[model samples]
Target: MGDAHVDSEVRFEVQGRLGVIVLDRPRVINALSHEMVNRIHAQLVAWADDDAIERVALTGAGERGLCAGGDVVVLYEDATSGDGSETASFLADEYRLDAYIARYPKPYVSLMDGIVLGGGVGLSAHAAHRLVTERSRVGMPETQIGFVTDVGGTWLLGRAPGELGVHAGLTGTLLGPGEAIALGFADVLVPSQRLPELLERLETEDVASVLGALAEAAPDAPLLDERPWIDAVYDADDIAVILERLDELDSDAARDAATALRGRSPSALAVTLRAIRIARGFERLEDALAQEYRVCRRLHAAPDFAEGVRAQVVDKDKTPRWHPATVAELDPAWLDGVFEVGDDELRFDIGPGTSGIITGEHDDGDEGARE
Candidate 1:
């Protein structure tokens, strides 16, 4: 184990047979910076080859949760800067990291305790053991900021049962622990207070045995009851038809969901829906991530991305004036542009031993935590 400061910058330690990763940015709820991602990637690559490390455990430094997501302020800067080199590098490396996690061979346990957000989801959701606490708040609220979900959001969210994934994407909804489990985002629930004891046990006990001893029963998910309506309304591929369907529902849940959808950037809604739909057919995490890269590249230059960031992050006004403010006004060609990967398209350098991935990041300061 290292000193407190050393641990804060993403400390990697071999505690007995366990490989421990502590995300140490408590001040910003353990947001993923570029440097932190690099450190994590380097260590993870090393650990994959080390026979002494029997299992891996990831957790945040503070009580706030695992991670907020990638650095959005940096993303905002990159988006508006005209030069997209930084943004491109971040997305490519981040996506590769996500793919590596999906394909990692060992026992990977993620303690998704608090606010596991967008970038945070990339870190935890693909683990062999994804644990959530009652205090956990998870989602991809990128739509509100005029960005579609990235970090393999389409792959994960698209695979959700029924139309729950589409609803989650369109509304930028944050799911609590129960909802998360119901949505298949988490594999187990362990009370936050018991996490330290679980970590202590991981030093000697296997991940499954420790979880079986400490995990609690998850509460019922209220969203499950609304699935009928969620499915009916969100099934439409066209955003306008989807909204129209929502408007027709007699249930208050439908009305509320409609209102939430209306408040988001129209372009983001359309693009997110398309991305999720496309992801439904993807055979690999890397494929979905590559598509997300194409979309993120196009979105960077789009007016709405910068404006959405300004309203939500910079001004804190929460009032973005989306061009093509309504779904009906959105040009199909513009939406199609997101799928066209340029010469600089992302490609994962995956391998048997090396898994070929790097670190991913999202901003902790943003309103939405990653799902």
Candidate 2:
């Protein structure tokens, strides 16, 4: 085993042929910072070129989870005090990292052990080998913070079977391993107790062989049973209509979903709905990321982004006063602007063994407990 490169928040090391990265901030559930993102990106780029490192694996420290999400508290401060430039830079770099992960050449394995949400999903879900444990609780809970899902969430969600992605995004529901795999966010379920052995085997064996031997059959996903209602209710692009359909269906799950959507930022819900629809038509993950970047850039200037974070994180009030309190009050023109491509857009250097590049010469640029 090689000596670890230890950042305060993240750590990297090489063990035999496996390069291991650990999210080390267990106190905050390993919430990611901009520095953490950059460090991980740089390390991944380096490891991609290292012939000695045949595979890379990511894990979070502590018992709670791999990552809770991004450090939204910092974002709240930046959005309120700065000119949105700082937030824009963070998004740019974060999205670029996500694009790179999606295109990584070497086997990238994510141990989706516990609470993986928002940016956590970005890190793990895009990997070539995504291993979820029975303890895994995965989701794109961006709507809870008055933010539309990013970090390639729209791409993942857009490609989900039926309307599972739409329901998950709009409601910000946390999914168990079964639901996560059923929704296509995860690949296999490995028992939590067996993870150590699995990692040990990775030091000598290929990812496919180790995972194939240790992976267990996932538990039943109740969400799968609800697909008929989920597809029926969330099939439309309009949030208002979806809510109406949820109410009209009159099932417990449908009503519950409706209640969940009602509490989130109206603008976030609307934008998420549209983003997923558009992402469904995209040919590549990069395209969805570029679209999400546009929507997220616009969202930084919106009142709900700050307000939602205030209520959810700063105050713990759980009552955000959305600028447009209702979906009906949302301005169609403003929504259009949210998806419009601006001077700064996210672009990737598309090819094997390449990382993403941000284009348009703009300024540089979380998850659940805090997504």
TM-score list, all predictions? 0.93, 0.95
lDDT winner: 2
The clash number for model 1 is: 9
* lDDT of every predicted structure (CA atoms): 0.82, 0.87
lDDT computed for candidate 1:
0.82
Residue pairs in candidate 1 whose N, alpha carbon or C atoms collide under 3 angstroms: 69-362, 70-361, 70-362, 70-363, 71-362, 71-363, 117-369, 117-370, 118-370
Candidate 1 local lDDT, 152-222, one digit each (tens): 88998899889998998788788889888888788889999998898888878888799989998997788
Off by over 4 Å in 1: 1-8, 357-371
Cα lDDT tens digits for candidate 2, 1-371: 66689979999988888899999999988998999999999999898788898888999999999999899998899889988887888887888888788777788889999999899999989887888998999988889889999998998998889999999999999999999999899989999999889888898899878988999988999899999888888888799899888889867888888889889999999999999999999877778888888898788788999999999899999989988999999999999988877777777665555656654432211010100
Q: Mind sharing the TM-score for model 2?
A: 0.95
Clashes in each model (backbone N, CA, C under 3 Å)? Answer: 9, 10
